[model samples]
Target: MEFKEVVGRRRSIRFFEPDKPVEREKIQVILETARLASCAVNAHWLRAIVVDRDKIPPDKLNQLKTPVAALTLDLAPVHIYFFCDLGVVKRIKGSRLRELVDAGALAPTHGWSHKFVDEFVYPQILEPMTNNLQGYLAAAMADCGGAAQNALLAAFDEGLGACLNTPNPVLTKQVFDVPDDWVSLWVMLVGYPAESWEAGGQRPRPPFEELYYEGDINTPFKRDPGVVEKLKASKMITAPAPLPGRRQEILQLAERLNLPM
Candidate 1:
């Protein structure tokens, strides 16, 4: 699919074909895409634990599900638990940055060098950030969000359905044997969709002007209707959600799956 179409088609798929297993290669592709996402300081804070739902003992799986995500957790064949490793910056100590310098990605023209990293970046900047744990976590988690979004987009591109869910963090840590330094983020529940790919239609968002600004706080970025039309033609802007027969579709799905109406 074209990139615009892929972006347009992405939906937080809630009902999945529980019995259908996602292919190993597709899962690897998702992870690979996430691995290639941009990160600050080359720290690469994002980490994931991929779990096969069928392989998990039923009791443990139950423990992992939160009140809101129980149905989603049960329906998805694969659960990818994402994390931001807080210790990565401290452990690597700017070695990854030095690697970028050595490879010329971080050029001398940008004032990047191993000596610069060791002297100024690590000791002065990175170390102090690490000392302020709350600030450090916020920054690292933002990087993880980018990587997670890549994984989500990859799932759609691979003809799969996925949703980001809040897992039971305490149970997740215990069941997955997560590292002490790792902070739990969302669990991406993935599988083949039981419903149509459109799932109704594109979900709603705030008005574009309300969300963005031009130069000043008072100046809203005026949206161009011509560009909007071009995007709509390219399928980037699609029909809004609660599409016709959406309720009937949900009812049928519920009846077929023996779920509450």
Candidate 2:
């Protein structure tokens, strides 16, 4: 599929084919594409754990209610958890001197030690500016979003359905044996979508004039009608999916997708 259609057609598909299983390699490809996303300090702050339908014990899946309102934990066959690797920032900071030298930013001829960064540079300059515990994890949350977005796109491209989920961190930790240092951010539910992958003609977006700004914050940018038409024709922008019937279908399936009481 064209990248434009892939993005435009992507939906938070909650209903998946219950009998179908996702290929192991497809999950890997989606994750690998996600890991390439850029983040703070080149630290690669995100790490992921892929849990197939079988990996997580049945009792563990039962502990989830919504994870987010309306998300059914067991509906999708695969769950990919995007988490903060707490040690990433420190690892990046510790390797700073060596990386700088290798990149030719600093000369090996310069008298630099861990003490230089540890005592002088880090304390006065780097420490205040760089990762503190609260700040580091906070930044990681932002970093993980990019990686997650990549995963979404990758899953769509691979003809899989996926949704981002907020699972209960406490229950998740118990289920996955998550390390104390790792933060459970969000999970991606991946599997075969039950409905049409085509746009459902329901795009809940603000008007472009309301969404985009001009030279000043107070001013809205007026988009040209011709340009908008051109974009629509090119699949660069999607029209609302064919409607009327679409909403009911989504609602009905959404109800069915919910876990049994």
Candidate 3:
């Protein structure tokens, strides 16, 4: 599938064909894409548990879901639990910078050594993340989001439906035999689509002019109309008009779910 189409069609798929199984090989490929996601200095402090519907006991799977996630998890063919591997930050040089050095992007004489990482990076970055719990949690969530999005796009490329979600963190962690440091981040529900794969028409977004800054906070930056038009024409960018009744439909669904509108 085209990259633009993949972006457009990538919706938070809720309904899935429960009985349909996503192949293990396909899951491996999606995970490879996830491994390639950018993170903090390529610390690679992340891992995942790819749970199949039939493999886990029903009671345990139920524990992983909250009120918001139950419907989605109930029907998903697979549930991928993304988490932070606290030990990665303990490494003197994380996987990424070493790989960069090996690729000749860094001169051996120019960059700091693993000893420097031990002396400085740990004291300045990793230590604070632990001593300051909020910082640690925020970094974990952001890192997992980056990795999960890569997997989601890869799943889309494989013609499978995937959705990113946050389940009840405590319950989810309990279900898996995670270490004290292996903190739960979020989940990605995967399977064959049970509904239309279309984007449900273009969704609403903040006005483009309001989204970005020109220099500082005061001035809003607008994209050049000619460039924007060209991108739209090539199907690389789209901002379709909203369909009528969409907001009301959303409100109804929220009401059904007992969620604040």
Question: Candidate 1's residue-wise lDDT over 121-224, tens digit each?
Answer: 99999989999988999999999999999999999999999999877777788888889998888999999999998899899999999989999878999999
lDDT string for model 3 (93-164, tens) is: 444555665676545588655655556665776666666767776786688778888899999889899888
User: Each model's TM-score?
Assistant: 0.98, 0.80, 0.82
The TM-score leader among the candidates is 1
Off by over 4 Å in 3: 91-103, 108-110, 122-129, 238-261
The Cα local distance difference test for each model comes to 0.93, 0.73, 0.76
User: Residues 108-160, candidate 2, lDDT per residue (tens digit)?
Assistant: 47766556655665466544645466775667788888899989999988999
**How would the candidate models be sorted by TM-score, starting from the highest?**
1, 3, 2
> How much is the lDDT of residue 121 in candidate 3?
60
Q: Candidate 1: where are CA atoms >4 Å away?
A: none
Residue pairs in clash, model 1: none
**How does model 3 score by TM-score?**
0.82
Q: How much is 108 displaced in model 3, in angstroms?
A: 4.8
- Determine which window of 10 residues in candidate 1 has minimal summed lDDT: 165-174
Query: Clashes in each model (backbone N, CA, C under 3 Å)?
Result: 0, 5, 0
Q: Is candidate 1 or candidate 2 better by lDDT?
A: 1
Q: Which candidate is the best by lDDT?
A: 1
User: What ranking emerges by lDDT with the best candidate at the front?
Assistant: 1, 3, 2
